[model samples]
Target: MINLYEVQETNKMIEESNLDVRTITMGISLLDCCDTDVDKVCENIYNKITTQAKNLVSTGCEIENEFGIPIVNKRISVTPISLVGGSCCKTTDDYVKIAKALDRAALEVGVNFLGGYSALVSKGMTDSDRLLIESIPKALASTERVCSSVNVGSTKTGIDMDAVKLLGEKILETAELTKDADSLGCAKLVVFCNAPDDNPFMAGAFHGVTEGDAVINVGVSGPGVVKRALEKVRGEDFGTLCETIKKTAFKVTRVGQLVAQEASKRLNVPFGIIDLSLAPTPAVGDSVAEILEEIGLESVGAPGTTAALALLNDQVKKGGVMASSYVGGLSGAFIPVSEDQGMIDAVEANALTLEKLEAMTCVCSVGLDMIAIPGDTKATTISGIIADEMAIGMINQKTTAVRLIPVIGKDVGEMVEFGGLLGYAPVMPVNRFGCDAFVNRGGRIPAPIHSFKN
Candidate 1:
């Protein structure tokens, strides 16, 4: 199991190819923290999360130093707050208090972000779910480290158009509340369809009701490594290109597996899955868009982009599954404009448009992500966009999400800096044609016919 050559290769990837563990997320279930009283629920949630994740950040640093691998973020995910506050949170303010409790716990444990300020209402919204969702704008506006998500559609339960319509309004409210920070609160909120139970990514990760009390899930990324490998086979045939990507992905996943195992053993938490997503960053070389360009496209949004992305996504999953038995989450390439320099370049060059990006989401890892629009865009337009993406995920039976920021006081071509790993983005224009009538007719869109397997 110990080989010098493999070790040297890994080191080279780390030092040159931008290989790094994206995040090591600890999923902590907060179901046991629920109580009949609001105060008790807050106390229980704070105590549980702090106790469970006390050593998370330190352990991550320890692993990084020992292995000489970069661990970018240490995060925690708790069970959806809607469920945890069902019995006790009778008002929106009650739910906001729970969010404050979660934020305090995150700070006490030294994690950068804490997820699971979430509500799952794929088919229908319960009273508690509605309350938590309604409180998101204030909750995010008030907290520093808390992130929120709402699952409004799934293959089995169809899309909850009611929730979709409500989220459109809430998202705008969130933007206005955080307008001073360039509407940063909207960046921390996500709307999902067919959301997975164990995604380690931010703005979307939550400890699903099905998971255990505690587990360690690691997300590994290497878009730069994949692009560099592709460069070696420039002009090679499709088969050669595919093989190169597969072999490279296998190697990368192995590194994540090692880290996940080590983190689990050290933290005494059971190992979850390894998410081998080609999650790009603002760094020059670490871009999924560049990898597509290397695949013979003149630019990322040009013809054959979807085919190129689909091929890459499929091969990555194939290779990742071979490296580890439990490969889960959004295990494919992510295309976020702010996070990836190449995508931002494409947007500035006028080669990538909102329509093109939406088409690409059909094949990429997640849906339209980290995109900023004008401050004056209508709430109905946002709801329409969310409905379209949700329909895609429900029909395809794959995880899809939207993290759009309607930057307050910003318009087309204006840049909003989110800073750090979130990078920056130009405010892209959305279609002005109204969808008021379509969005106003609210009810569940029935599950696809293919969902009748039972």
Candidate 2:
């Protein structure tokens, strides 16, 4: 039932490649933590996170040591604060207070990031959603660890053009607000289509209504490992390549499940999901682009790259689903430009463009991530990007997102460094021909025919 040589080869790849788990995120639902009083609500939120997630870091570290595999980030995602505080918070300041509390809780628990300061305005925005989006800049600027997101579209609901327009303006405002902080606020915010509540990834993760009140969702990443596997099988047939990737993904996802179970047991939180996304880092050897290269592309964005990625993504899900009973979130291979060194290199070499990247997202995980564009790019163009990605997700019925940064004072081919995990990206050019009329239509793109199934 197994190939020892193949397993040994994959192990060698894991050792040589800079592969590691990207994050072990504990999803703590705060619905039960809600209250009519603002102070009481904040207290409940704080208590729930602190109590349920107290041992998250330690457990993650123990798993790392026990398995000899690095776990890069220990984090938490809670129910969208806007929804939890809807009945209690009357104004923007009330939401800000809750965000500050989340920041403090994250600091106290020793986690790097805490997500779910978010709202789902895909169909329409409520008063609470408006206040939450309005306060994102202030909340992000004031708090160090808190992250935010807004879901502007989904498969069944179609694109919320109004929400997309507002988020476009919010992106510019957020970038401007944190320009002095290297646009760090924008780094912490992600605008998503078909956003998942159980996602364990940063800047966009949140505990959705369907998830348990308190649970652990682990995100396993190892693009380097996958690349190395592909390298050893160079010149091999496509069937062999697919099998190799599937076997490797089984190993990676198994590690994730083990760590998630241990962390959940130690923290007294229910285990949620294993997101088997091959999330990359800025470091060498750990790159989704490298996997593409190993899969026969001279560089990412080359011809046939999409087909290779589609096979890779499908194989990963197949292996992960078999490895664990519970698998959710945006699980596949992430191709964030700045976050992956290979992707950054590809962009610099003129091998990749925004359009190509968008095309790739149709087959990959997490659409149009960490992309930097000229500051002068119109709001409508940015909205156009979101619209395009959302359309893909709606049509395909999968999770996709756009986290493009309109770096202020930055131009095409220029670089804006966010430093550290956020990494750096060259400002890619946008379409000169405006999408004004398309965006100005300002109405929902009706859900696809497929979504009408009873």
Candidate 3:
């Protein structure tokens, strides 16, 4: 428990291997803020968020300085706005007022991003849920530091085709509303199947109704650390490769445990789970694709790519569980095209396509993330894509999400830049096909047979 060598090794991992805590997120419940008047609802949300997260940023900075470990972002997540404003928010504009209030509170508290502008309509949509879903394009276009997500499917409730079809149009509207910024608003909106309650990552995080009033969740990432460890066992057998990744993951997660404990104690909040995802960045050598390449793949979309990803995802979870008692969220490998340089390179080389990426999500942490498509693509096609991903999550009982941006005034082979951690992406081509007849058949897809285990 008291050793100098372990501390020194952690420092080396930080300095050379790009190891760091990705986010320290505070999940604040807004259920008590509901009111009959829209104005009062907004006031309660603003006051609660600002008062609760007042010291979040400063505490994160203090931890970074005292421990010499970099904490990338301090953020917040709240109860789904649809539930919080159900009694008061009568119209789309009323829901958007709450969105503005959330953005204001985030700015005042000095957090990087605030999530939970969301509705959970897995089976069907209530009036409040429909209003919030309708307000997403305006809500995201009008706010900064506020992110939104909608859960359209779950293993128990099955998929909601109505919500999927509606969100297809809303995503396109969001792209048009923020076209001046390269359709950046859509980047802040995500559609999920089996979305987790305690996720600390942006654009998909929400404080589930099952959570306590307020808690602290930390997300830790270290793709570079894993890659460097693999290099040491480059020519070794499969058993050696697996062991190295497991041991390396254990060490990296310990650092996250330290940071989460410190942040919780200092902020007077209960400690939540640690999300040990291999979330890559645009920086050099900090890529999940590079890790796959290190695992002997020529490129990310080659014949054996999905197998390598499946192996990497399983091992990451195996070692992460051993390191922490409470491991939750999407705690596996992420394959965002824009965020990882190697993935971007693969796309430029015509090695990765949308179809291959969809196949990969069957095993990866999240599905079809941070991908840019052409503007002229039809809304039904987008809905079709969403339905396909939802089917995967529903069948496998895993959490999967889609964050697609139909960048306006751009086509395939063109580039769209979303600077600073939300990296740039090459606009990938989508299959020119029609699915209007299928998505228009608007009803829930019944849950799979295994879901009736109860």
Residue 342's lDDT within candidate 3 is: 95
TM-score of 2: 0.95
Off by over 4 Å in 1: none
| Tens digits of lDDT, candidate 2, 181-262 | 6566888889888898789999999989888777888898878888877887999999999999998899888778877888
- TM-score to true structure, per model: 0.99, 0.95, 0.99
Query: Candidate 1: worst 10 consecutive residues by lDDT?
Result: 297-306
lDDT of each structure?
A: 0.95, 0.86, 0.95
Candidate 2: stretches off by over 4 Å: 1-14
Clashing pairs in 2: none
C-alpha lDDT of candidate 2 relative to the true structure: 0.86
Better of 1 and 2 by lDDT: 1
Flag regions of model 3 displaced more than 4 Å: none
TM-score of model 3 (CA atoms): 0.99
